[model samples]
Target: MNDRGNASARLIAPLATLATVLLSIAGAAPLRAQGGAPPFDVPAWAFPTAPPPRPGTVPVVPDSVTRHTVPNSTRHYTRKQVGNAFDIPDWFPRQHPPMPAPVQYGVRPEGRACGFCHLPDGQGRPENGTLAGLPVEYTVRQLRAMREGTRGSANPAASPNPMIAVARGFSDDEVRIAARYYARLQLTRRNIVREVAQVPTTRVAGLLYALDGTGREPIDGRLLEVPESIERHDLRDPWVRYTTYVPTGSLTRGRRLATQGPAGPTTSCGACHGPQLLGTGDVPPIAGRAPSNILRQLINFRTRARRDSTAASMYPVVDSLTIHDMVALAAYVGSLPPSRTPRK
Candidate 1:
């Protein structure tokens, strides 16, 4: 074989091995099911977990199709009818990016609306990526990656990564419209990261961490972060914000890694993410994103699950990160207030 073929083989060998291991592990150990058990059961070395729900009444899963409704035109529309939470008051615009029918409704019997998970505001949940404020090129590239099978979740059992399946079904025009709409929206700080010795009781409601009641418990070295109110979040109320709790000093340690790169496996984040770490030319801003998401992305890079050209840039940094190091890095990066422009 030629040198290029050899190089490709080298990369593919380990990834294929890893995939086999993952499939084996998944078959042996299933992730905790929703409601039955905690929803987020990622390897501590790879991803963070939400604190266990406090014992009490089962936390209400926001599943009432009729209850989750919003006004559209002159009548109220159910979540299913709207295809997304776009109609939620105080959150979405009446008509954003003049969404094409494909974006507002599904392409047909199979394709789901883009806004279903991304929301009309484009601020996605921890389970998915935040699309708002991304550069159009960057968004397009990711969609293409999904279509081409280069980008995917490292932990499929933990996160099915619905986008991969969805993207595969999208036409080019649908991809363009969805990308443009999300790109046009602004990226803002909708969440804060806090380190705590103990966290409030939380339950896994679908892909969200929700408070089960008004009580706190030792996190036992685990991290738990979620929106204060699941109801408000479902409404897509922009005023609704999220709070993430981590072990104390994780942020401080993470700041050191981010700003100094103590051991030299990686350089200071400012080198790439800009002085303030908001973002650079094509690099999307990571400052205000969810810590879980950041940690997940880092893990994906390490495992080669996200092997797009841009993700390749992260391999060196993440490969050297220990789980604790990842936790610290995510905590610190997530703590920084989001900035859109470079410092003057």
Candidate 2:
């Protein structure tokens, strides 16, 4: 291996063991979950388990006969066209570079189009993490981990995890293509994050929360991530905005936990995620992502569900965090603006 490669390898080994000895000395108390599970337990709000799809929720409509339109969108798509997973919804294709075949259209047969759920812009929704401006190498590694079963949800048995099936279906070349496409896709905007004590009542609407007209209720110390307009979001409008209502004082607590740590300075998130929590080298940036996704990853790391090499390095840092701590960290990090410049 080249000298630089050797240096890089040397650098990585220590990170996996980062703050381990010091953290062991700290010996944090076990945090209890709402259901009396471990500290890393999946919080209901962050990973809001969607109800099972009703048998007749979606009414049958003629594909070509029905026309669908979203706000500010001049283009129209038929019911069949929108339902076709192979044909992604690109509401504003001019805003981004042309997506590679793998991104614009999924690898045939088993693979689903990359843009379908993530959106054509790669901005993604609250259920998944952002893909835009990600390091290609890092994204590739993550995809590989999913394919090999090394990456997974902290709680998987309860809900369907599509990434595993999707990753398994992707050819390595296709993975690279999609990763490169998303990497080159610049971040256009940040999701709206607000810390509130009370939030609008919500209903489970297809793996995401949608505000119910039943009036406001206490946030109850969890993140309430919902789309500004569920109808627009369902239309796969890449420009659709989401409002994540975090617990009161979550941002301040999260910022403190990220910078100062629970006890003292030890492998702070910024150390690997960059000074502004953007990212460093092949490490994925955490800022401006969905707080739900961030919390899910933190739970995955702490629970040892995502066992990829880089995630192993997150053990010490994530282990120190409780659900509340992770919530604060995710809220603060998610509220920040993403890095505008590309990193090599």
Candidate 3:
């Protein structure tokens, strides 16, 4: 098995009892704010909120103390060291290949390392795009798209653009270096799709959500994806898997939509991406990626937030879709396995 192996099977929660379709219907409302005269309605749930304010007082940890460690980690770092925004904490460097300058330590002042958000393994979190096993050419194109004005967030008010800043700041050589390194690394499955009527209450932690397990709320048609353990997540564990709680029956409905467009409103995803949704050629794999990440891309394309030539085909596809339709498609797509090849 690959040294990191994937998260254990138990990490993915199974779908609980199904809820009526009525719950999914409730989220059909459009976005309250408009970035432009969007061709399609934007859904608020697709955007992540800003992280909660940090406590004014953080318990001091002296440098004399031994470095802190996470379970099974050989690397150790002090709290101050681990929180460095310019350098990524590669808790398990052996888990993947070596990182380049842009991947490990980005340019000071303006650029942030790709690994800081995409993680060392490139599985990525709900907040950013995944780079693992992506096409080298495609990756470069995306970086160019971000550097130029072709790609951007549909909801800029939700959070500032980290990718855009990095794209604009980094030199072209550094961009190519980061792209090739991550492109060679295989992407493991880290998303666990589950359908449930209720989900544990959660709070925004950084760009993603973390469930508290103490409270519960009705799953009224939105996907709630959070790390299995916030403690492990806080450690920046690359092996951490996320469980996405989607409204009941979203998966089944999504499967039909992906395989067949029903009428002519949407196109079958398999038509462009491979039948497995693992992508083909320049198209990147969608299987087992973050659902929120997927949902946002769909929304962005429809809203013209991403107008690159690559996304041209998706504009019409997402244009005719509703909020619930997008949710189901994201849920079903996230449920698929990213790859079957074992790593070591």
Candidate 4:
């Protein structure tokens, strides 16, 4: 019995030593792999990572988004391609109304009619913005933006020949004539305001109204401010641009969304734009402007069709907004004041 016990102890001693050595090696392996720190000792959130640069690929740095430049002056001439001008056919409208010739200008020259780019009845093509049923002041402000170069042409590569070129050449009187023409034209029933009731109180802008749970006053009666801040971001020389007016209630709704909303994934308007809804740096103004244009732009952003620097900034914000929010916001912005022409 004593001799058997001695043999078992001898065997157990060496085996125990071997097991400890193996355990030591196993424990040390992770530390060695991680350059001295044990695998478990590393921070819970720490990820094993290397610098972004790879052997053959260059590292990429994101560019800062900027507002599009607005032009100061424009050159005009009779376009040679009258047929090529923007044209809207009668079939485009779900319901077409009889449009009288613009009373102020008599008849638009061969290529000078609203339908030229916006199509015959103002169903604008995707390439160009729509102009159907836009308020007179809103249309005027946009024309002025084009004339002054504040609003740039959508196609950058097109060079000197672009939408801005067409707008820049238009005289002030011509702009007014066009504004009046479109303002008088009745909007298609299909284009009638939807989501009017769905608009939330939180989305309405200054001096809350029925839309925002305030006074039940109709929009047509109130004097609204133009969204110069949005224009400022979109235009180059905001000082030189003209202002327009929209319904007070609509502008109020626009202001709420533009100024306040979600954070983190979605940013507030004041975060990128300045306080008071004026744009920061190159960001455009949104306080007072045309609702139709604003709605069109928001739609463009949502669809990823209008991808300029300024629009890109709005991508995150717009993505978070519901369709109802978008409509309410647009209605609000369209009601603001136009750029007050400065006194010379």
Work out the TM-score per prediction.
0.74, 0.83, 0.82, 0.31
**Tens digit of per-residue lDDT, candidate 4, span 1-344:** 01112112221211224333443343311101111211111110101112234588974442334313334324211222222233322322333345434311223232244555554444343224445545566566665654443343211111222344555556667667666655544322111222232222211121111122333323222222222343332221223222322333444565576667533524766676555444444455554443444554664455333443334566677665654566567655444432233112
Looking at model 4, residue 191 earns an lDDT score of 16
Candidate 2: which stretches are off by over 4 Å? 1-39, 54-63, 341-344
lDDT of 1 by residue, 1-344 (tens): 11111112222213344445554453322111111211222353233233346889696454435744333333444544433432333234553556555456656544677666666667777657688777777887887887665776656444335676677677777788777787777667777888888888766665556777867777555556578677756655444678877888898889888888644735677777778777778888788777878887776666666777787666556655666787788888877776554222
The TM-score measured for candidate 3 stands at 0.82
**Clash numbers, per candidate:** 0, 0, 2, 46
Runs of candidate 4 exceeding 4 Å displacement: 1-255, 262-266, 339-344
Ranking by TM-score: 2, 3, 1, 4
Scored against the true structure, residue 145 in model 2 reaches a CA lDDT of 81
Candidate 3 local lDDT, 231-294, one digit each (tens):
6776677777789999999999999888886336348888778888878998888887888889
The candidate scoring highest on TM-score is 2
Model 1, position 36, has a per-residue lDDT of 20
Ranking by lDDT: 3, 2, 1, 4
lDDT of each: 0.63, 0.71, 0.72, 0.38
What's model 4's TM-score? 0.31
Could you give candidate 2's per-residue lDDT for residues 60-92 as a string of tens digits?
A: 664777788987788888767776778777777
